[model samples]
Target: MSDEKVKIDVPEVPSVLPPAEQKKWVETYKAAFEEAQNDDPGDVVKQRQSALREANRLLRVEKITSADQAKALPKWKLVQCEEKDGVLKVVTIDGKKYSFGVGRGAKQQAPAGQGGGQNGAGQQGGGASTPPPAA
Candidate 1:
């Protein structure tokens, strides 16, 4: 087999600003570089190394190994949770509703009719169920 290495080309990120804004960016870079050079070399190197290490640590991918750990993750406030027709309906404080199917052989309980099909905003189920107010 040939030992030639495959080359991959990466496209440059496109800038949204016009050419005039690009010139202003160069000025900003020069000012920042000058300010950085004014700092002590040893201190600057230490700070840069620390920042890079922290950034790499943060960027590293993490896996959730357990259901308990996954449940402990930060999430939106649950406004309401109820079981309806073998489906678990969860509504969050932001008015988003999610439905999860109940597993086979699991206990199925009928949800109380109170607050059924209504969101935390007191509005009926989303999408065409309620008419828009008159303009």
Candidate 2:
């Protein structure tokens, strides 16, 4: 129990991106901001409308062809796979809890609570015998 003060040294965290790349990115953002500020309001509105239409079109056309495609797609994590339904669902990791189905190929899978051994042996009434005597 002393009144002495201790100073702990903490190292600075290294940047994920190289300094040159970080500077380039900052400049790019700044230039984009300035350009947006100087652009005509009508032009901005038209650009936004075109972007919205393109996004809607892509969403309407998007489909998952395979499990690998679904896993490679951004912003979603596969939570469960059900072969009987020919559908697999994924939830978005970005706090949205958004779920979407991906088509699965025809494959037989064990039915729920049947033979998967998910339930304990005790619950299934499989007899558990006590060990005779310690050696």
User: What are the lDDT figures for the candidates, one per model?
Assistant: 0.40, 0.35
Model 2 TM-score, all chains together: 0.25
Pairs in clash, predicted candidate 1: none
Q: Estimate each model's TM-score.
A: 0.24, 0.25
> Poorest 10 consecutive residues of model 2 by lDDT?
5-14
Error of 2 at 28 (Å): 6.5
Top-scoring candidate (lDDT)? 1
Instruction: Give the count of colliding residue pairs in each prediction.
Output: 0, 0
Per-residue CA lDDT of candidate 1, range 17-119, in tens?
3455444544444444344434433354543444334323322223323223323433423455556564566544435454444556333222223345532
User: Which residue pairs clash in candidate 2?
Assistant: none
Indicate the TM-score of model 1: 0.24
Local accuracy of candidate 2 as per-residue lDDT tens digits, 27-61: 44444433443443335444343433332332221
Residue 86 in candidate 1, Cα distance off native in Å: 1.1
